[model samples]
Target: MDKLTIALPKGRLFDPVVEILREAGVVNRELDDDSRKLILEDEQLEIDFLLSKAVDVHTYVEHGVADLGVVGKDVLLEAGASVYEVLDLELGSCRLVVAIPEEAGITSLEELPSTGRVATKYVNVAQEFFDQQGIQTEIVKLNGSIEMAPLVGLSDMIVDISSTGRTLRENNLIEIAEIARSSARLITNRVSYKTQHQRIKNIIDDVKAVISKQ
Candidate 1:
């Protein structure tokens, strides 16, 4: 009957996850992120939330700093963190794609050269993907503004997550390859999963129930 600490990504996925938590009866009151506080507590429920960047959720759970976490599949792939993926929240749905500038005249992954430069924050994903296709690419890691790389000739293409094609269309980028689909995932610390089995399972069931209705 101990308190459980959960790591939640603090970005676009935050609101949706919070809504699920509320609907699942994990928290009694409405949760708000527009605050200076990094941790939010629900004393009655014996739950504490660690609000963090999307990329660090897996790390915290893997290190046991958090018993559970909500993160994206893209981050889990890029970070290669060791944690049990308990459930797919299915929020923040998107796709990881390889895109090239419209002027490149490349219509598919087959049309691209054997060796080229790719700009992406997901270096591991990009490397693994191209290697599987028998193509070699120099992955340039850029934290943000990945679309700008191809426009300025910094890279031949980009491996990025695109929720909608609008951003790519605005930047004149066309997706030629889809590496993977991504969504919010629930992950648990290995040891914690066993040590706090029922408590964790209760929340998982609650969340799953809420998600099934959506």
Candidate 2:
């Protein structure tokens, strides 16, 4: 069997994903979140794990650097990368939403200026969503702190992933619309899925079984 490489996102989803892998008997050693190592191997399972930023998981899998990856649906939608999303792990649940300042007096997309500025880390997702709604807006790509955009006059609104509405409320932002619900998913490289069918199937089945028990 060819050695399988799996990519795990390093954030809120990390610990849960590691626990699932352990339950599926795919990982033998304890994974230290504080470890500096980017790669970990389990000889018994013939697997190598790559810890990466959530946004980079798709890139690693799409480039075939890793055979499998655990990432959020939000990243997948934003990236639009060519990778086979095989299963929803049901972890890291969140929503992609459009938000505006509480005092903006914009209760709906239609209330905003015909041409406005939107800020987000998810540029692609934001563009697609607004374009589909026939709303023309300039997208400001921000790597972090999207909430500050509207507050500081950088943008009129923002598209961001929200697990809870707490952050938005605290920042005096209101969710104007929900673009999509997001959860962690199991994705595989297209070629790897075809070339390592049985092995990959076994791993998927193990994960499904564990999820079923939960």
Residue 197's lDDT in candidate 2: 89
Query: Quick one: RMSD of model 2?
Result: 1.1
Off by over 4 Å in 1: none
Residue-level lDDT of model 1, residues 1-214, one tens digit each, is 6889899888788898988988988877556666678888889888888888888999999999999999999999888889999899989899999999999899999999999999999999999999999998899999999999999889999999999889999999999999999999999999999999999998899999999999
Clashing residue pairs in all predictions, respectively, total 0, 0
Alpha carbon lDDT of each predicted model: 0.92, 0.92
Q: State the displacement of the C-alpha of residue 199, model 1, in Å, after optimal TM-score superposition.
A: 1.2
Poorest lDDT segment (10 consecutive residues) of candidate 2: 26-35
User: For every candidate structure, what is the RMSD over all alpha carbons to the true structure, in angstroms?
Assistant: 1.1, 1.1
